[model samples]
Each structure stands twice: as structure tokens, then as C-alpha cells.
Target: MNPSEDQIYVIIFSTLFLGGLMSTFVVAMVFIHRQRQAQNKQKLDQIKSEHEKTLLNIENEIQQDTLTHVGRELHDNIGQLLSLAKLYLGSSKPEKQQEGKETINQVISEVRALSKNLNLDWVESLTIEEFIEQQLQKIESTGFCKTTFEHSIELGELPKDQKLVLIRVIQEILNNAMKHASPEEIKVKIWKDGATRTIQIKDNGKGFDTSIESSGSGMYNLKKRMETIGGDVSITSSIGNGTLIHLLLPN
Candidate 1:
């Protein structure tokens, strides 16, 4: 009743081969699962980036619409009112001339200020470097913050949109430094890489965490603006240390 030697050897060989095959199958399944998970993660990241870009574009469109409406209102409604006031002043009774003159002067002054806000002639006519220098001059006149600007790239030929966006970014940075950072000095630099433009804004101030709860809407808006314009923004800071904002844009 004992099995033959040849039969026993055949049984052992069959068992070993099956065992190896099963182990190979298990390993293959694990590798396949890991590959699928990695693919899913990559897809998720792409979707998130696309979503952020869409949201930024929408916000920029809304901002542009609002600015256009406000500009038109100032030029048409407020400007016409001021013109009417001036016309009335010329024909007012002699006894009331003084009062009318004062009223007309006040109206004219308000109109002029409104006009400046509505008209971005500075952006259209001046290069980014010149415009930044002019802004620095205004800040310097305040005597509140010592400002310095340096440039390694000639930004004179940048597109108007890019120049305007950079200008606004710089303005927001300076405003934040003055109002919140409480820094006595601020520095701005612009340079270029092979096909990229770089801007660095730095301030010695009480820095905050870069977490969601720590930053305000201003920083969020700035990041959104940069993304909308195909640029990237990065902020680095810590408590008691200075804040540095780096912006990069394709040239």
C-alpha cells in the first residue's frame, strides 16, 4: 500500500511549483494596487490645480468688471456734476458769488481726486520700473518707511497687464508693511531668469504663520491674482523674523 518513489517525487514537485505560482500572483496584485493608488493621487492633484485656476480666473473677471463700472461712474456721473457746478458758479448772483465759488472749488477738488483714481494713465504710459520708482518716491515722501528698490532685469518691455499686476502687488505689500508689519524699512527687487521674471518683497516685521488661520484675505487675494496671471507667489516668515514674498512670472 506504500506509494512509489517516483509518485512521491512528482507530488512534491507539483506542490512546490503551485506554491511559487501563488506567491507570484500575490506579489503582482500588490504591485498593481499600488500603481492604481499612485495614479489616483496624481489625478487628484491635477484636478485640484485646475480648480484653483478656475476660481482665480473668475475672481479676476469680477474684479475687472467692478473696476470698469466704477471708472465709468466717476467719469460720467461725478464729472458731469462737477462741470454743472462750475457752470452755475459763473452766473450766480454777485452777493452769492463767494459761496458759489467755494462750492465749485470743493466740487472740482473732489472730481480731480476721483479722476486720478479712475485714470490709470501711469500704468499705460510708464514702464514697470519707472512706475515702481514713482511709487517709491511717494512712499519716501511719507517719511514713515525707508524704501529701497533694486532691479537686475530691465522690465521696461513687459506687457501692460503684467506691469499693472506687479504694481498692484507691490502696492498691497507696501500697504501691509505700513499698516501691519510696523516695519521701518522695506526692500523690493525685480530680476529675471531665462524666461521668468522674479519679484522679491521683504520687510523686517513681526511675521506670522503661513497657515490658513493666520493669513488674511489680502494675502489670499494676492495669491489668487498671481495665479490668475500665470504666476506663482510664495511667502516665508516666522515669529520675530522678517517676511519675504517671492513672485515669479513667465516672461
Candidate 2:
């Protein structure tokens, strides 16, 4: 009942050939998988490098802006106070001399407040809500516009780097409102919506059409910046109406 010798040899040859083919296929699959893995790793590394570069630029811009603000305060507020003090101190009257002493004390206090802003180390400890409130106060102090801030609860926190980016972006938005919008009211709100933390800035200023693309790259840059931090920026506006900007971050 056994097969012939020739039949057995044919069977053995076919079996060996099929096994070789299977091994070759497996080796090809492994090579392809490894190639894809390498490609993915390279892409991730490039993204990491880009994110770090963006963060560095944000840090530099923040520092420069702080310096500029400090310089202005020194020249406008402190310098004027010093001049007034000098005039008062030069008077022979006791009341005028006493006024000069009080003015000098005021100047000292103002200088100390400005000194804290010279460095960015304070940003590390400051929360996002606090920053927004401080900016609003500054705007109100200018008498250029009335400011309002509303928050339902404490917004979630972000890492220091992300926090800095958000801070700069918000500052730019507020500045744009003052420079271009000239709105009577600038209102900011913060709240949590589901899995997102939202910061909304509303200004009753002359708004522009959203349909038409802007010649400037400001909005584009803002969107890209939010993307870098896994967040998003949304702006809604119409001519003669007002502008509303929403800065959204994931919880």
C-alpha cells in the first residue's frame, strides 16, 4: 500500500519549496514593518523639534514685551512723579515739603511693582485666570476702555510652556482690540465646557468680515500657535458689530 519511491521524492521536494516561500514572505513583512516604524519615529522627532523651537520663540517675545512695558512705565509714570516731587521739595512751605515726601514714597512703591515684572519667573507661579484679570485691570486703568471679567470657576491649569504661549496670545488679542478696535467695552470670560476649558474675549468694536481672507498673517499665526499646544482659537466677527475670540484648551 506504500507510495512508490519517485512519488515520495516528488512530495518531499514540493513540501520544501512551499516552506521556503513562507519564510521569504515572513522576512519581507518584517522588513516592511521595521521601515514603517522608522519613518514614524522620524516624523515624531521632527514635530518635537518644531514644538521646542516655537516655545523658545514665545519665551523670547514675552521677555521682550515685558522689558518694553517696564521701560514705558519708568519713563511716563515714575519720571513724572520724580519731577513733581522735585518741584514740591524745592518749595519752602511745610505742606509742600510733606507732599514731596509722600510722592517719593509713591514712586518707590510703583518702582517695586514694576521690578517684579522684569523677570518671567513670576509666570511660573501665576495662574491663567490671574493673568487675565491683571491685563483687564491695566486696560481699565488706561481709561481707554471699560473692562469686564467673568469666570464660572477656576479654569484648569497647563504646563509652564503652554501657559506662556497662551498668555502671549491673549496679550496680543487684547492689544489688537485696543489698537484697531477702539471698543468701548472689552469683556473676558473663562469657564469649563465638557472636556474643554474656554477663554472668551469679547469687544464691542468695529469688526471685520470673516469671509474675506486677511492680507495679514496674524490670525494664521495664532491658529498655528494654538495647535502647537494642542489647543484651538476661534474668532467670530462682522462689520459694525463686534469681535469675539475663544481660546480653547483640552482638560
Candidate 3:
């Protein structure tokens, strides 16, 4: 069964054609898989964005509710006490009257400062830095400590949700300093480097064991929240030294 040379050539050509066709189909399949992967990533990003927006709305509602509760306490409780003091001062003996009046004035000043922060409208309109300053000012007004804040111009351009989350984190840190640090002063610095914005909070109070404190839910939550936004949190501390919190945001 010997075949001619023409038949052999035809067989070789047919084999090459089929090989080329298979290669093309494999390439097409790879291209389709990449397209599907990209589509899935886009959908996931959209879902994440919607979730963050919902969280921000909840934060706003909580702030408003807190404002109302504080307003009521200031008016119903401290306001009435101050009025009573004023009335008592009016009836006191001459020398005692002067002392009472001076005491009342001091209380009034502190109360007025606190009242300024109770306004929901004012709180709503503030930028992140302004809100931080407000909280710091309240702590400093107690006459126990001083707080300083510095920031780059780029910080003001952050998205509202980003700013909101940062403010809460800073608040938590500030509260920790005020309650536990025994710090004479707290310093806050904010700046931008390329696509990243950073905030550094330093205190002069006695630092603590980082390993022991890392187990706290507050700090863990802080790290988690930052991670959700593609950011990071780092803390450094040593006993008798101070604590430093470095926050990095991908802006």
C-alpha cells in the first residue's frame, strides 16, 4: 500500500492547520477568563463603596443624638445649678458676696465653652482638623493639659467619609491621652507624602507595654477600620517615655 508524495504533503498540511486552530481557541479562552475576572473586581469595589456610605450615615445619626442628649443635660442640670448660685450670691453678706460672684463667673465661663460644642449645626459644618481642635480645646480648657494640632493643606481635600473616620480615631486617641497618659501636652501633626497622608500623635505621658496593650479592643478596632479604607495604624510606646500613634491614609 505505497502512497504517492502528493498524498504525504496533503497529510502534513492538514496536521499543521488543526494545530493552529487549537492554539487560537486556547488563546480565546484565556482572554475571556481575564475579562470575567476584571468584571468581578469592579462589582466588589462597588459593593464596598456602598457599605462605607452606609456606615458614614450611621455615624452622623449617632453624633446628632449625642448632641441632643448633651444639650438637655446642660440646660436642665448645670443651667439650673448656676441660676441657684447666682440667687444665693445676691443674698450673701458683702465680703462673701464678692467671693461667690467670682466663683460663679468662673463656672459660667467653662459652661459657656462647653455649650458651644453642643450645637449640632456647628459640629456638622466643621472640617476634620477643626473638629480635632475643638475636642483638644475642650480637654485643654480643663486646665489640666495643653494640646496642639498642625496639618498640611492636602488634609483638607480628603473625602468626607475618610475625614469622619479619622476624626473618630483621633478622638479615641485623645481620650486615651487625657484619661491615662498624665501628659502635660499632646502634639498632633498631619502631613502628606505623595499619595499618602499621615497623622502623628505624640504625648509626653508615661508609655506602657505595647504587647500588653495591643490586646485592647479599642486599638484593634482602630487598626481594622483603617485597613478597611486601605490605610494602616502603627503605635510605639515605652514605659516612662510617651506614646506615638502614626496613621497612614491612601489619599
Clashes of 3: 0
Cα lDDT computed for each candidate against the true fold: 0.75, 0.91, 0.77
Best by TM-score: 2
lDDT of 2 at 33: 93
Over the stretch 172-201, how does candidate 2's per-residue lDDT look in tens digits? 899989988989999999888777888999
lDDT: which is higher, 1 or 2?
Answer: 2
**Tens-digit lDDT string for candidate 1 (1-251):** 35798898889999999999999999999999999999999998986786566555544653674478667866887667666666666774774566567767776776666555555564567787786688778778988778899999886676655666776777777778788787777888988878888888898988767775544687887886776567889999877887999999755
Candidate 2 RMSD computed on C-alpha atoms after optimal superposition onto the true structure: 3.4
Question: How are the candidates ranked when ordered by lDDT, highest leading?
Answer: 2, 3, 1
lDDT of 2 at 133: 91
TM-score of each: 0.55, 0.83, 0.65
User: Candidate 3's residue-wise lDDT over 1-251, tens digit each?
Assistant: 35787888888999999999999999999999999899999999986986586457547754775687677867886677677667768875886677667768866776776676664445346777787788788888898788888887546556656666676778778888877889999998888877777889999998887888554677887786677666899999989998999999865
Total clashing pairs for each candidate: 0, 0, 0
- lDDT: worst 10-residue window of model 3: 116-125
User: Candidate 3 has what TM-score?
Assistant: 0.65
Candidate order by TM-score, highest to lowest?
A: 2, 3, 1
Candidate 2, residue 209: Cα displacement in angstroms equals 2.6
